[model samples]
Target: MAARVWRDPVLWLAFGFGSGLAPVAPGTFGTLPGVVLAALLGLLAPAIGVPLWAVVLLALIVLTPIGIGLCGAASRRLGVHDHGGIVFDEIVGVLIPFLLVPVTPWTLLLAFLWFRLFDVVKPWPIRWLDRHVSGGWGIMVDDLLAGVFALAAVGLSVHFWPG
Candidate 1:
């Protein structure tokens, strides 16, 4: 099973390119790819004559559905519901807060921390959705909501603090 998972392309993606395979803090490790992705998008924006926020948003739009499918399929393949090893959701989740926001080392760190907090803490509706929803949507929605929560928090912080 482990060998099969490692060999499968879909599983490879669902595992956040193996970051999700970490012995501890899989989600944190999974989120690192998102950080790298966000940074790459940020760098690409200027060269493409696009805004950073736009580039990130476009990526999220593209990746969210793919993450959902990859997560769902991987979960089915593993015969587990939202397996911890499937971190595509985490990859997608971390991108939400960075959307429409300035990308800086500080902001990226804050987004990562905030997204992780909301994801792990699973507040209110996020928790509710996580428990009730099923399949790919089930696996993906909670983290998306967590990302929204983090986005709000990050937005507020940036607004009042204005660093």
Candidate 2:
């Protein structure tokens, strides 16, 4: 079973390139890829002269749909809904805060912490959506909302603290 999961391309991606396969805290491990992706996108600002926020926006636009498809398909294949092994949503979720904030180490750390908090807590609408929605969109939307919560929290923190 594990070998088949590793060999399948869709599962490979939906599982966050094996990060989601971790014995514990798979979401946290899976989010590492998003951090790497966000950092690379940050670099595009100097390389192509594009703004970091714009690049992040474009990345979110592109990745969200792809994540949805991959997540939903993986769920069907596994005969499970939003399995622990499916962390593509987490990978995409962690990218949201970077949309408007500077991609500094401090910001990354804050984003990770805040995103994880919101994801784990699932306050109000996030929890509601997580329970009500189903399939790929269901799995992805809750985390996306958590990302928004993290984004707002991080944005405010950066604004007031300005470190």
lDDT of the candidates, in the order given: 0.87, 0.91
lDDT of 1 by residue, 1-31 (tens): 4567679999889998888888899889999
Best by lDDT: 2
lDDT of 2 by residue, 84-149 (tens): 889999999999999889888888888888999999999999999999999999999999999999
Query: Which stretches of candidate 1 lie above 4 Å from their native place?
Result: 160-163
lDDT of 1: 0.87
Global lDDT of model 2:
0.91
RMSD of each: 1.4, 1.0
**TM-score of model 2 relative to the true fold?**
0.96
